[model samples]
Target: MTNWDDFRLVLALARTGAIRQAGAALGVNHATVSRRLADLTRRMGGAVFERISGRYQVTAVGAPVLEAAIRMEAACLEGERRLRAVSPDMAGPVTVSLPDAIARVVLLEELTAFAQANPDISLTLKCSYAYADLDRSDADIVIRGASAPDEHLVGRRLFPYALAHYCARDYFDQVALPDRRWLVRRTPAQWIERSPCPEAPVGYVIDDIDMLHEAAARGQGMIRGACYIAESDERLIRIPGSKVEPWEDLWVLTHPDLRDAPRIKAVMGLVTEALMRSRALIERGETDRCRG
Candidate 1:
């Protein structure tokens, strides 16, 4: 019988098509992967993969084995998720995945408080723009900005993600009308319809929101960003005639299987409440100074 670990090696190799990449995925070195493949070949009495143009391709004989491996892997992951779902104890790790901007500007303080309050539960945050796979257990909780979340997940839509144009106070005052520019993440066509200064030429095309915010703060040019982020920055001020545009809704999500777990429930509650508390600011950038 093939060891499950060896099967995993095969699966990894099949997925990545390179010994080095497969090793990296399995937390082993390329030599270990190669040796394991060699050993598997000896035991199976045939080659599982063929090298074709510098990439590993599964052989016809290996196809059935790969299919079985995939089934086994899925069953293992499901079993693990089921076990976690029924765990009554609140004293294990819970991972939350969210975008870096939201993690930094919005939920940092609240999440910190949650950590202090729940010392027994280890909290891990995966901050990125990429979505983590809930079905694969990549994250226990996810806070995302989307028009509609995956229907399989269980969670609440917190509020509309609002955005508006802003720039450094000094830049707003000092830059002449024609000289002023817009700092954007993409082509102006994407946001020009919503911009107060549609005529302003694009000054800088920055893809990272954090970098764009910094540039705007440094008086480089105007930027359109999340209200919750830019409105809180004292260095930046909204453009005089800018209107808040509603984009996708912000959602807090978790897999249905894990939703009932004690620790998952607790964390989800905390996050939902924290986000809801800021609904006004999130949905419309409402503030005393910004009130129409």
Candidate 2:
């Protein structure tokens, strides 16, 4: 009988190149990962990996087995998700991934209240602008602002949010607005069509949102951001009558396994409640910021 569960241990060690990295990702102690790796080596008859100069490398014999090990890894994840889906009442930990802006502006402040009410539930928040892997169970839930994601996800609309340009009041007051000294994204020419000046930004273009946002925040230069974020932060003030694009939906998504879990529902409801409370600022940005 083959223990494919042991193969997952092999794959994790193989990809991570060291026992420590694999342990961190799998949330186990280094000693436990080491023990499992040793246990797995014996059953496989020949050594699967060799440590050379502080790096783990797969042997030629082990290389061919990697493809099959990966398939077992996928099956193990699917099985875990299925068990979690079936066990609706169990709760211990749930992980959520979202952008730093949203997490800081909203979730961080209110999580304490939820924690007090549900003492048994522990929440882990991962802050990143990148899309986390739901298939790998990177997070049990995620908040995203965009169109839809892959067909496998179970997602729901929280609300539609608007985008707008903002700058520190003092910056605009001192330097003057739209004088070609500001930071700009090379969006479609249609985006440049409605600037306060007949001549739009001629230089100093930055494409990354974080750089553009930091420039605007420090009053170095101006850039656009989601209204709910820019308006909530007292550090930034919206530039009224600026161009407004159409609103996009903010989503709460989870693997289908968690689609009906009570604790997941409670946390998501808290987030939706927060969004509703922010509705006034969201709408104000849409009306006050659109130029044409």
Candidate 3:
């Protein structure tokens, strides 16, 4: 009989197409992944994956196995969800996934208070740009910025998310309009064309939002960022002519199957209430100090 554990290896390897990546996803070492793949291949009496150039490609023999693994994985996730749905205990670990920026700027204080108030419920935060697979139980709760959430997820649209152009206060005062540039997350041309300063040069292209903000704060260039984050920073100030751009709605979501669990419900309620209380700041980027 094929071990379900081996099938998990197969799924990971097939999805990632590299031993190292698969191991990283599975939280195991590359050597362990290799050894397990070798053992599984021996049992199957043939190779499952063949390296073509640099990547592992699924062999003809492995295609059906991959399909079966996918089905089994779905069934396992469904069973887990069903079990959680009926769980009565409110005291246990609940993981919330969200972007690092949101955790830092908006929700951290509220989440900290939640942790303090509920010592019985252990809170785990997975902060990343990558969306967690709630259906797969990657997270019990998810806070995300999205145009619209998936049909499988249940959550509230907290507020409209917005971004605005900002630069270091000193930079804004000292830099000549012709000399200023943009620190951006995308290609220079893309940002420059859309920006108010179309003729401005690109100072830096950074993938991380926090790093981009830092660059802007250091007077490297102006940056377009979520209004709440940029406005909260004392080092930064809004560009003179730039306007806030409405992007998407901020959502707090969870899989329907797990939504009814006592801990999940409690966390969701608290988080939703907290976010709603800050809806004006999230939507318009106006804090008490900023308004003053």
Candidate 3 ranges beyond 4 A from true positions: 19-47, 189-191, 290-292
Model 1, 1-292: lDDT tens digits are 4589977988999999999999999999999999999988888889999999999999986888899999999898888888878878887889999988788877899999989988989999999878889989999999999987789999888778899988998886688999998888988456775678878888879998888988998999999988888887888898888889898898899998898899999999988887888788888987656521
- Candidate 2 regions with alpha-carbon error over 4 angstroms: 1-67, 83-90, 176-180, 184-190, 193-211, 283-292
Tens digits of per-residue lDDT for model 2 on 201-254? 644777666567777777776666777677665667667567655476778888
Question: What does the lDDT read for residue 110 in candidate 1?
Answer: 92
lDDT for position 232 in model 3:
80
The numbered model that scores best in lDDT is: 1
How does candidate 1 score on lDDT?
0.88
Q: For residues 1-292, could you state the per-residue lDDT of candidate 3 as single tens digits?
A: 3688877888999999999999998999999999988987888889999999899988987888899999999999999887866868778779999888778876899889989988988899999989899988989999888886898799787778788888888985689888888887888356556777778888768989888888887888988888878888888888777777888888999998887899999998888887787777678877766521
Residue range with the least summed lDDT across 10 consecutive positions in model 3: 283-292
lDDT of each: 0.88, 0.72, 0.85
Model 2 is weakest, by summed lDDT over 10 consecutive residues, at: 283-292
> Could you tell which candidate, 2 or 3, scores higher by TM-score?
3
Q: Residue 182 in model 1: shift from native, Å? A: 2.5
Order the candidate numbers by lDDT, best to worst.
1, 3, 2
